[model samples]
Each structure stands twice: as C-alpha cells, then as structure tokens.
Target: MPEPYALLIEGGTIVDGSGERGFAAAVGVRDGRIELVYGPTDQIRAERRVDATERVVTPGFIDLHSHSGLMIFADPLHEPKVRQGVTTEVIGVDGLSYAPIPDPTDLEALAHINAGLDGRPDIAYDWSSVESYLDRLDGLRPSLNLAFMVGNSALRIGAMGWDEVVASADDLANMRAMLREAMEEGAIGVSSGLDYPPGAYASTEELAALTAEAARGGGFYHTHVRYDLGDRYLDPFREAIEIGRLGEGPAHITHFYHRQTFPDGPGPMLALVDDARADGQDVTFDTYPYEWASTRLLIMIPPWAQSGGPVQTKERLADAGVRDRIRREMAERGVLFAGRRAWDDVRIGAFTVPELIPWEGRTLGDVIADRGDDPVDVLCDLLLAEDLRVNQVTPGPWTETLRDFIRHPIGMIGTDSTFVGAKPSPRTYGSFPRVLGQFVREEALLSLEEAVRSMTSAPAARIGLDDRGLVRDGFVADLVVLDPERVRSNATYDEPRSYPDGIDRVVVGGTIVVEDGAHTGARPGRVLRRGG
Candidate 1:
C-alpha cells in the first residue's frame, strides 16, 4: 500500500541520546527524517537496509566550539570531521571570523590575525554580511552542517579601527545596531575573545550593551575569558559572569578549564560557576579532553604593543625597547608559558612561512637553544618574520581537574580545534572518540548513555535546535554506528591527522556519508540558521 521507506537501520543497540539505557531496536528513515523507531520483533520494509548488528547506534556528535568556518570553504570534503562521526559544528568562536565586515580592508585585517588558526585559503573574500557568508556556505556543499555566531571582534572592527581606545557613545550605538543586524540574519548568538586585540580594548559596559542586543533577540553570549591560571586568574571569570548579569542573557563559557599552575585546582574555579548558578544566573561551559591547549602564538605579545593590526604589531616587534618591555611584562606577570610550564612544554603547532615548516612540532625552548639566542629575541624575530601568523600548543591541566569538570552537570564537549597547518592539535581528529574510548569504556568516567547525551542532546539544546540531536520520530536522520568495544582515538600529538577506529558508518539526512569506515563522498550538509 504505502511506499517503502527510503532506508532502514536494523538490529542495533539504540542509545536514544536522552540519558536512557540502550535498547535493541530498528530505525526507519524517509524523506530525510526518522519515520519510525520500532523494536527488533517488529517487521519493517525498506528500499535499502544496513544490518547494524552488534553495534551502538546513536545520534551524530555536535561540536559546540570550532574554527572550521573558513577552512571548510577551502576544503569542503572536511574528511577530518566526517570520519569522526561529527554531523554539525558551531563556528565563529573566540569572537573572530570573516563576516559583517564594513569594507574589504577590514576583512583582510581580520584574515591576517586569524590566519594562524584558520589558514589563508585561496577562496575569494566576497561577502560582507552574515547572510551573504552563510549563503556562500550553502553553495559549497560541505560534509557537515554549520551554524554560526556573530563575532564581537568583527563588530568592533566594523564600528572602529584597531585602535586601543575605549568605545564612545556613538561607537557603542553603532556596535549594537550591527549585532542586531547579525541576529536578524540568522546568527545563534554573539561570541567574544577578550584577550585578543580590538576586542581586548572593549570595556565591560561596551560588551554589556552589545550583548544586550543579542539577548533581545533570544540569543546567548559565548566568551573566551580574558585570563586563565595566574595571579589575576579569577578576575576574568568574574567579569564574564558579571557581563551576563548586566546584559540579562544566558552565558556559555568556551574552553572552561583549570591550568596546571592553579594552586587549588578546578575546585576553586568550578566553585565560581556554582556560585553564579546559585544566584540565578544562566551559565554553562565546555571543555576538551586534553592536557595541552592550542592558540595563536601572537597572543603572547603585551596588549599595549598590539594596538594596531598585524603590520604595525610586527613593526613594534622590530624595536629593541619594545621587545625589552614585552619581555619584562611577561616575566613580571608570569605570562605565556612561564608559570604553568617551561618553554620546553611549548611547541609550534603551525606557521605561515614556508621556510618554517621544519619548525613545526619543535618546542620553542628547543628552537631557542639551537639558535643560541635570548628567548625573547628569538620569539620576537619569529613573529616578525612570519608577520604574526604562528600558532602554539602549551602543555597544561591536572588529572583531577579534568575529571571534576567532565562530570559536572552543566558541562559539555568542545574541541576548540583550529584545523590548520601540518601539526594541528590531535583533538581536531580525536576529541569525541577519545571521550568514548578512554573516558567511557576504559576509565568508566561516565556511562555510555550519559556520554552520548553530552555529545548530542546537550549541545543541541544549547543552540536551540529542536529537530535534531536525538533519535526520535520526525527528527533529522543524522546518526552514527560504532563498535563500542573497539572505538578509540588513534591520533597522537606527533601524528595528528589520523582518524579514529571503530566508526562503522555515518549518516547525514538519511544519506550515508561514511560507509565501512571510509568516506563515501556524499555532501548533503546545509547551513543552519537560527529560527529558520
């Protein structure tokens, strides 16, 4: 009578992503939505069938924080993510992206600062509004769905230049208008990188005013706190919480973790979050499962010396007096990799200069030792030569600290992975699988059902996606099938590009993108917009 279902996945242990226990069931798909989820005893007919016997069937993962916004345009296949069972990624993180630019110069300036994290792809910089940029993505036909946030840095640059001055009344008004426009163009929220320039110069009142506009549109505020693990460590967290209160919006902290230098560990840091929540403020956070953290190497420069764009910053780095001031400030404040770990713990993750390819994977301390020069001079020279386009990975975190945060009720997962260069962090390819294999199966840190919920339902709820992130009737058919016993991340810091093991198949919108542990070249992904 009725037409046969388009596809069927039968005889699998269905972990429905609601923190419930797994059950044996069969799932049917038709018109890109889940048609039925029946028990194994029920008979179902389909045009095609996948015998998912002895496997764990769950919803595909959602990456809450990612830097693949521009990189995806360069390489639309995005094998690194699709192979790891990721179906959606939230981009425009750390408040730096290429949308809402006022002019071509603003886009170029932002691209230069962002080149270390997102490589300078050969694609055209054709769009200036959030809607136009999202339309460009829709035409690219990527492998995973993409959702975006309006970047605060882009907002600041659009309203003002890269000067270190605070915002005036007119400046604040212009920024608010820009934020409202982006939200109307389908952005989920606004994000900020307070430690980086342009955004670093913004005052608390300025941030509150702009975030209030996002709140008025039913969007949240995501921020990478100003500082982590130092004498002034707690101040930044307090500032972020205060912003959410002042702006009257939900706040989500990106990459919330304790550094090894913290004397009391994550207990004190997480206590701050508890206090905020107890006071009736909406706050949540995400973290990756790794001991080393990665970011642009230019962040180590003193804020005073980084006023202008990359060109001016490079000019200052060439001055001896400025270099001395930077070194003194770093020493006095215990900045960079000083307090937490030695220079040997800091490795070069990526560089823009072709000659520096050999330096990839080498420690900064090792480079200084081989060059026979002062550490400060060596660092300044490298940045100047590379035009501030460099990335670094510093080792950090304690075992107890990681366990405490991951088990917290409001905690979710985010890779914070910058997918660029030859030696990117292994988390880019291994984050979700590592949590499943090491944390869930090997160490028993969390149950398989709870882990699935964190990767699926929790992130979906955070971004307000109603039709995805769960294995339910009428939901989008984005799912993963894996062998729980054999699932594990094979990527290492040395060889960071390798994919994980035990992912049998990955489906997006009822089409198989990865089958038999290999990519099938299906590009069914679309750009997701807020309230669309």
Candidate 2:
C-alpha cells in the first residue's frame, strides 16, 4: 500500500537527538517526513532499504555559525560539511552577509571586505534583499538547508553609507524598519559583528534599538562580540548580555571562547554567562573544538583606519604617513597580530594576489624574518596588494580551557568555518566529527548522547527550527547514520581538505543525499524561513 513508504533504515540504534541512550529501531520515511519508528522486530516494508545494523542513527548535524553564504552558489557540492553529517547550516553570521543592499556600490565594498572569508566567486550580483537572496540560493539547490540572519553591517551601510558617524534618530528608525522587514521577509534573526565596521561603528544604544525591533518580529540576536582578547575582552561579552536584556530576545554568542590573553581564564568567562542567565537573560553560546581561529587578516587594522570601506582603506595602506600611524597604533594596542606574541602564531591561510601564493601556509613571522622587513609594513603591503582578501589562522586558548568551554551546559557547536581558503582550518571539515571522536569517545569529556544533543537538537532549538533536528515520527527526515567505533575526522591542521570517516549515510527531506560515505549529488535542501 502506498508503495510501502519511500525508504526504511533498519536495525540502527537511534540516538533521537534527546541526549538519552539509544535504542534499536527501524525508521520508515515517506513523502520527506518520518512515517514510522518501529522496533527492530517489527514487520516494516519500504521501496528501499538500508542495512544500518551497527550504526548510530541521529538527526543530521546543524552548524550554528557558518560563513558558507558567500560561496554556496559557486560551489554547491559542499562535500566538506555533508560528509560530516551537517544537513543544515545557519549563515549570515558575524554581522556580515549579502542581503538587503539597496546600493550596488555597498554590495561591491562588502564583497571586497568579505572576500577572505567568502571567496570572490564569479556570479551575477543581482539580488538586493533578504527575500531575493534566499530565492537565489533556492534556485542554486545548495547541498544543505540554509537559514539567514540579517546582518547589522548591511543595514548600516544601506542607511548611513560607510562613514564613521553615529546614526541619527532618523537613521536609527530606518535601520529598525529594515530589521523588521528582513525578519518578516524570512531571516531567522539579526546578527552583529561588533569588531568589524560599519557594525563596529554602531554604538550600544543603536544596536539595542535595532535588536529590539528584531525581537518584536519574533527573532533573536546573534553577536560576534566586539573583542575577545586583552583587558577589554569581558566588556564585549557584557555588552552582548546587556543588548539581549534591553532588546528582550534570546542572545546567542557565536564562537564563544577564552583567548590565551585572558588573565583569569575560562572560569570567569563562563561565570559571566551564568550570571547573565541568573539575571533572567536568555543567553547561549557555541564553540568549535579547536585550538586555532581563522579570520580575515585585515581585522588587525584599527577601526578608524578602516573607516571609508575597502577602497579608502587600500588608499590609506598605500600612504606612508598613514601606514606608519597604523603601525604605531597597532603596536601600542598589544593586539594579537600587532604584538610580538602573535608573530609566530599567525599563519597565512589564503591570499588573493598571485604573487603571495608562495606565502600561503607560511607563518607571518617566517615571512618577516626571511625578508628582514618590518612586520607592519609587510602586513600593510599585503592588505593593499590583495585588496583586503587575505586570511590567517592564529593560535587559540589552552586545550584545557577550550575543553572547559565546550563542556559547559549552555555550550553548543559552530564551525565558524571559511571554506574558501586553500589551507582552511581543520574545523571546516571536522568540527562535528571531532566532537564525537575526540571529546566523546577518546576523552569522555561528554557522553555520546550528550554530544549528539549539542550538535543536533540544541542548535535547532536555539534557532527555533521546530520541525527538524530530531529522529522521531512526523519530523522532516534529515538524518545521519554513523559507525561510532570508526567515526572520526581525518582532516588535520596540516591537511585540512580531507573528509571524515564512518558517516555511512545522510538523508535530507527523505532523499538520500549521501550514501556509503560519498555524496549522491542530490539537492533536497530547502531555504528555511523563520515562522514557516
């Protein structure tokens, strides 16, 4: 009857995404939804059958913070994520994304600044609103489901241009209206990158006002806080909590971590979150299980120096006087890239200039030492030559400290992955599997079920996706079957592009997108809209 349903996954131990011990079951799928979850002995029939005898079946992983929005259309296969069982990703993170742009000039500048994280793919620059952009993605048929967050920088540039001026009352109102419209259009929430301009240029009051508007439209605020190192590190976290309190929505801190520069350590940092939650604030955070971070090298330049967008910043980099001033300011700030401690830790991950290809995979300290050139001069010259499309990886916090952050009750996982770089961080391909392999199996930092919950249902609940993220009846069938004994991330810092092992099958919307550890070239992903 009815073709006996579409597919059946038989004899797998179902993790169920609930942080509970798995039980043997046979799952049946029909019309893109889970039709039945019966005992192993039940007489189930289907059009197709997968023998998942020794696998742990659970909901496909969800990446809470990803930069894939930039190049998903250019490279939609996305084997790196799909192989690791990530069926859904939340893009438009760190307060930067392509959407709601009224001016073509603003979109160009954004593309230039974000090139390092999202590659400059050859595609038509046509769409200009959140709805249009999502439509564009749907037409491309990307490998995984994607959700968007309207970026504060996009709203700022749309309203105020790339100037350093604070928003006037009218400017603030326009920005709030744009935020509301974007949320209503389909965006899941509002995201702010406080360390990157013009988002960095926004004052606390301006952000609170915009966030309040998003909350009114039933969306939360996701923030890549202003700073994570030095004396003012905690200040940004405090500001995020304050914004959430004032905005009256859930606050999600992307890539939450304690840096090596933190004086006290993870204890105090986690305490800040606990204290905020105790104060009736809805605060949650996500962290990748890695000891290195990847981002644009242009971030080292102070905010004031980067005032007039990429073109103006390039001009400043070319001027001798301005270059010297920037160098002096960076030196005095004791920031990561500017200070001596970071010299050895910073490695070039990607470069747009053909001349700098040799420097990729090389440390900045080595380049400087070999050339006998000034560090600041090298950095400025590189930024100018590449037009701000360079990426770097730097050492993160201590292993023990990072472990503590992940084991925290409120902690979830986000890759913060930039897949454009040649030598991308291993986290790009390995974050979820690494948790299952290293943290769960190897170290026992978290139980297998607990880790699965963190990666699957936890992030889904955070983003308000009610239908997916659980292996249960009547849910959309986004599922993964893995061999727990062999599931491990093979990608390492030295070689980052390789896929993982033991992910046997992946299904999205009842279609087998990945089977027997290889992508099946099926595009069943949907553009997930808020309140849909």
Give the root-mean-square deviation of each candidate in angstroms. 1.8, 1.5
Per-residue lDDT tens digits for candidate 1, residues 324-397, read 88888878766564742477877885675777778888888888888988788989888877877788877644
Find the 10 residues in a row with the least total lDDT in model 2.
35-44
lDDT of 2 by residue, 6-119 (tens): 889998889989888998887889888886566553466678999999899999999998888868878888888889999999999988978999888889889889887777
Model 2 residue runs over 4 Å out of place are 40-42, 228-230, 337-341
In order, candidate lDDTs are 0.84, 0.86
- By lDDT, who's the top model here? 2
- What TM-score fits each model? 0.96, 0.97
- Identify the leading candidate in terms of TM-score: 2
